[model samples]
Target: MSNVTTKKEVNVFIDYLARCEGETALRLNVDADGEVRHYEVKLFEPPRFFEGFLVGRKWYDAYEVCSRICGICSVPHVISGVEATEKAFDIKPGKQTVMLRKLANLSELNMNCIVRIYILGGPDFLGVNSVMDIAANPATLDVVKMALKLKRLGNDLTDFCTGRETHPVGIDVGRMLKLPDKHKIEPLLERLKEAKEDAWKVAEFVASLKVPAYKRRVPLLAIHREDGYALNYGKIKSTSGFEVTPYKHDEYISHKHVKQSNALFYSIGEGQSFMVGPIARVVLSFDQLSPDAQKMARKYWGGPEWFHENMPFSVYAAHAVEYMHTTDEMISILEKLKAGMDESEIMKEKAIPQKGQGFICTEAPRGLLYYTFKFDENGDVQFADIVTPTAHHVHNLEQDLKHLGPSLVGMSEKDATMQVELVARCYDLCCSCSVHCVTIKK
Candidate 1:
């Protein structure tokens, strides 16, 4: 951290926020009167054009290529794309396929949240530039060690089911090419069951951090499943009390590229922005959390009102709670698999793809990621649209930055800039997954 001299104004341009994924900039300008004169968020990382790349490909190919969009988000991207494609062809996977897919998602969510809450957000709360700054610090190093064990547990779970951690190969349209039998699932279930104690320690460690607080009240949106806390399946629900099916996202949601920027933002109406991810999940579905997670959340925060849109720091707490939820739920899912409670869907032959459109929303580690596809008669993709969680969040993040300006403007350039950067970290922005090529610049 640098010290502020006599400068009344300072510009902060982070080439890619340290610790977060991808390369992008969060630039802010502050004036002498404790006011933010200029606030701009430009996601200029060169684009991959995944949607365009998928067009003219087969439905299965869409899932394959889309999974390459982000390493952290691969599970959700691949799962959502597969489910949407299956829907387009009116194919339904059986009990085993659904359970296996949920396990993969839960594994990804726990690992991804660990990275965000402990690795990226850790330094910010510790008043350091990066985790390396605190690697030798006795107080914080234990959290890092705990995070590593939890992270491996998540990756191994995914690997057992998906064949590899990143860009899993097994999952496909309708069902996976191979299913893990009780023999393979039992050991992993034991590992997950054993990790419960560690999960509690990490949850308590995270809740002890003093996250900076604010009072902005943006709407939080997440998937709402009737069976439980929604993850892979549910209608989308907003904190403002609106619900819509996955297929109707197009009807109720609209997104456009911001002026001079390629990153597309989603909105429900004019001048409206909403949040997603763990914070939204907890706010919108706290009661739905597993009993263990609900118990942990109750230890620190008083009630739902304590989870505010402006308090981006609470996102860390939200992740911790979700980590417990995913861990507990995975143990249960694995037990079900071990008991032969349902028939393995792989026992049936695969279905053929047909002409039609399909849509789906899966709760990724970040938030609800929506995918839509139109297939030709031969099951080749004719059109594709992917609405990433980050796409829906860029604007919401900027809004929080702008609102926090007053509190930071009076500080020296160096101090204020670091604090503002923490504000962005609160969102755990994944620039690599969100940035799209643009004709405009800031």
Candidate 2:
């Protein structure tokens, strides 16, 4: 047995994750022989306490308040809260409302994924320090231009429908509070159609980058919609062969408090850490993707093989595939809405809250997000539990680090540290959302 060495110990404190969303740090404990015996994925941001504060707020406010949890994921947060509240009140959104919300979410998904794949994760794969580095180089300058072009289209679509790109103000308890004018839908649709070439360019650029070779077999999970690619509604399905409606989440998912970090770690079954995000969704729902996207995925990563191999870095490629799907789906939805624009039907009536609990799952850009709420007859929230995608997979990230640490033993300190950061970036951890819940043990 090797003794724990106090001599020549290297304590690496990574204070800034250049591409990650919020305040986070990694503490690595490496022994004299360069073996990482212990590590802590530390989150420095103060807990947001969204659940605690939301308990007594009005049901209608859940959608608005929860959106503040994350700027990058506001659409999914708002949609999840609105859907869960509607379920609790026995309210069904009208067709127009559903279409509008779906449009906003898909647009936001594209916008968010573009940032992750091109700006945040791209620099790592290209052997550059940052996106600015890529932009500065004459050889890669065109790639940046294409990324911004596609990203702008996504932002314009999201803002056009929801009234704001970040914290959307258009969605309400049962329907959209505002709809895009009939005259403007055609122009927006035309713009979306025109951007198809740009979307393809960005996807091809990402496909060409080479990710580090590492594989760890972990269970994959995502929202499964049989009809098409799931954005807001679906059953929670896992590669482990179990599918359950979102209402059954409490029965299967569990969260625990770890002393190393402020974020709560989530697991399934008997303490098994599973993955939820772009890679999981792309692998599990390949057939459901748009036609061109599916064909491209087959060209690069084989059909069934992507699911069988649980490579964390493949998330970059998975995100590229999604970019294609979102553009096509957005165009289809806009065309449908243009054909039928009925104002009266959309604004019929909103339902009052009932005394019961509701639960829901929605696919955010990062992964599966779950929300459950208990409301009183007066439409006031009595209990609230919100789980972000980061909380769901932070434990899985740590597990990957544990397995990867041994192999990095003989590498240079700078090289080992960069390797660790690359793996963390693959998960695209949103530290802001994960720190929403924390327990202080006195």
Candidate 3:
């Protein structure tokens, strides 16, 4: 056979292999004028079993139970869940307690940012399969070294602030189990400054990548306040301008059941859709970023327009800005810390037997996380609903993939797969966080 005929047969064979291996494909049908007429992202469910284990647990224990939602994000889950409980009880943790909680959350954000950007996004941008590739690339080795330095800074700060890195044990019902001395906090603040600077440099490097020209106008959802992008608390708002408080989260949000997946499908308002997470935060609070972050953002991207339209390349730059912002916030709080508050000051009153509903909304590193719980007289969980940001953004990921596929229809299969993987990473879709995974078997 001629070369064209042989290549055509090979292509057909590879397509058959893809189908047999159960590889999920994004099929895009493009019209004569190069417009996308139809698109879909084929998603296959990966093995996950955590949501089922959460049913029937006491409200007080939900914090510990839901913490397992993701090993990387356990601290945020635990702290946010506990805060929701406190809100339901109408208890305000003392000033010192609140500050400590903020510190812990900031530490978690810093660590997560490092891992996602340097360890994950870095390799992908450089066309490498993993961090090891970056280490091996002579041109990218400095980037790898800087990422490691920043990661270490996050790990050390987390250990000092929360008493451990992977799973912190400092958070409690009303306060931290223990507090780091001023001496320890002082050095950590210095380390955070260094990490923030290094992260900014890496972000600049990411901005230089040649990203595909993909755009989508999906509505971005996040908590916004007059103050700025609320990290630990605020009202929920969307890119299309819908806004509500945490107490009314259910009114604007709803979940659907998808076959073959335990993950709940999320929708905003009346439409089956996606909401929350990093992209949403960047869209909602682009103006709130610090001057340094804003300058860097513009250097990488012209303005909010680049981020608002679902550009996957924006993830690295946005993550860097958030890391710097969170680091600065942590340092300010540590500087303001005062002595002389007894443990009793930070602890809440004895647990009372009463019916109560509590709601808490915080900016998890991934996106907007919400925890709501109704407790009975015995402090048992009568009703529990935890809406993770990852779950909220799944539909958006699907939508993006669907739109991207048709553009790659004529490309080589391997090139198409790379494009899809890049889109998936844009959402920073942590199947570990969403209790769902997407696998390309072929």
Best by lDDT: 2
lDDT of residue 179 for candidate 2: 75
Give the clashing pairs for model 2. Answer: none
Error of 2 at 385 (Å): 0.9
Write down the lDDT of every candidate, Cα atoms only. 0.78, 0.81, 0.67
Decoy 2 TM-score against native = 0.93
User: How much does candidate 3 score in TM-score?
Assistant: 0.84
Q: How accurate is candidate 1 locally (lDDT)?
A: 0.78
lDDT per residue as tens, model 2, 1-442? 2223433554555887779988767767666665777877766667878888888899888778999999988998999999989888888888888888889999999898799988888888889988888989999888788788778888988888888888998888787877787787888888787777766776678778887777787888899888999876889989888888777876788878777664577888888889998888888888899998887778777764674484787787788788888989999998988897768645756668899888888999989888888999998999998888887877888888877776665556677678889998988989788754433324
2 or 3, greater by lDDT: 2
Tens-place lDDT digits, model 3, residues 1-442: 1332222211111121121122333444444333555544444535444444445566657787777676777778888888878877777677787777677777777777778776766666667778887789898788778878877777776677677877677777766777766577667768767766775686766667666677677777787776755777778888777788777878878777655333356777665576566667777887776666677767767767777764555676677777777777776776776333356653555445356888788888888887877777667777776666766766666667556755664556566566666666666655556553343334
Ranking by TM-score: 1, 2, 3
